[model samples]
Target: MGEKLNISPGELRASAHAADTITKDLGRPLSKALEDIAAAADSLRHWSVGPQLKATGEGWGSALGKLRGRVGEHADGLRMVAAGHDVNEENVLNRFKGW
Candidate 1:
């Protein structure tokens, strides 16, 4: 098998710092937007036209689903990038001891 490449601690720290910043920036805006959308959806129940109200609710649901997908992608990217730094020779050897 080929030798494993090692990631320096400094590089890991930098990558983690960037991810933290990005998560904070994105999380706040997405949370606020989702809250506003949910409030709007709740208010739709007060509409007089039943079909129109239901349509509005469905639109909100679809929008929320898209927002969730975006958030999930960002979160997964952060995790994957962070995982790249979560390694070392000792840990790798320990994990693959039988190999």
Candidate 2:
């Protein structure tokens, strides 16, 4: 087979850092917005058209919630990728030694 692949975790770690930054940027403001929306929705619940307003607020909150969740997941995924690459290299070395 070709020479054993040489992999470095530096780049992966950098990517993970970038992902984490993005997650914070997206999730922080969104969390604040969600809280505001919840308060607004609660206030609107007493009006005649309150149901519609509440529903709209809920929809917006839901979408933002999903986005924040996804951003968090993405960051987690990147961090996992960064950490996993080192583990993968160790596994390969162990298998190669066994062989």
Candidate 3:
């Protein structure tokens, strides 16, 4: 006999909640860290001896911001999908906890 995978509405809702939690947790710290890094980078850029170094620092900071910017978007998208699932699943909270 072959085993089949069983999923319940409650499980789906729980998974969506978890996704939302993870997104918030990750986004909160990332924003703070990025701010601190940007401030330090700005200070370093200001004190640099040559224009080249200042420009490099500015370029790197811009790149960092651009790259990390997508994290929040991706997290938000994940959370949006999860929230949709929560609403779409009927009687989600009452579903069985199938293993």
Candidate 4:
């Protein structure tokens, strides 16, 4: 007779719990520049590319207002993404019991 393999249900339960906790903890939108870009998505899409370019050149006097600038911060985030690093900040309050 061949021996049967058995997997512990407790191990699977623990893994599922850990994944759920991490998902909730990592789901936060925490960048002022990102927030601004998201806020302008609708207006940005409505304007044609050339018009948007010319409007931007016209300075902040245009109806679209000033173009948001977060070049350095956005670049840093891009680098982190390129490096395969998770950009989300870990939730300090969500650590295993006693944390």
Q: For this target, which candidate reaches the highest TM-score against the unseen true structure?
A: 2
Model 4 clash pairs?
none
Poorest 10 consecutive residues of model 4 by lDDT? 61-70
Could you give me the TM-score of model 3 versus the true structure?
Answer: 0.45
Q: List ranges where model 3 is wrong by over 4 Å.
A: 1-4, 46-99
C-alpha RMSD in Å of predicted model 3 compared with the true structure: 7.5
Indicate the residue-level lDDT of 50 in model 3.
Answer: 46
Model 1 C-alpha lDDT versus the unseen true structure: 0.62
Cα lDDT of model 3 by residue, 1-99, tens digit: 233545454555566566556655766666676566566656666565444555555676566566555555555565666567666664565574463
TM-score of each: 0.42, 0.55, 0.45, 0.30
- lDDT tens digits by residue: candidate 1, 48-91: 66446556656865686676566556656656655665655568
Q: TM-score rank, highest first?
A: 2, 3, 1, 4
Instruction: Flag clash pairs in model 1.
Output: none
53, model 1: CA deviation in Å? 10
How would you encode candidate 4's per-residue C-alpha lDDT over 1-99 as one tens digit per residue? 333533234444444455455444433432333445545654566667645644444443332222222333344444544334222223433454484
Residue-level lDDT tens digits of model 2 in 52-99 = 767777798788778767777776776787688889888899989956
lDDT of each: 0.62, 0.74, 0.59, 0.42
1 versus 2: better TM-score goes to: 2
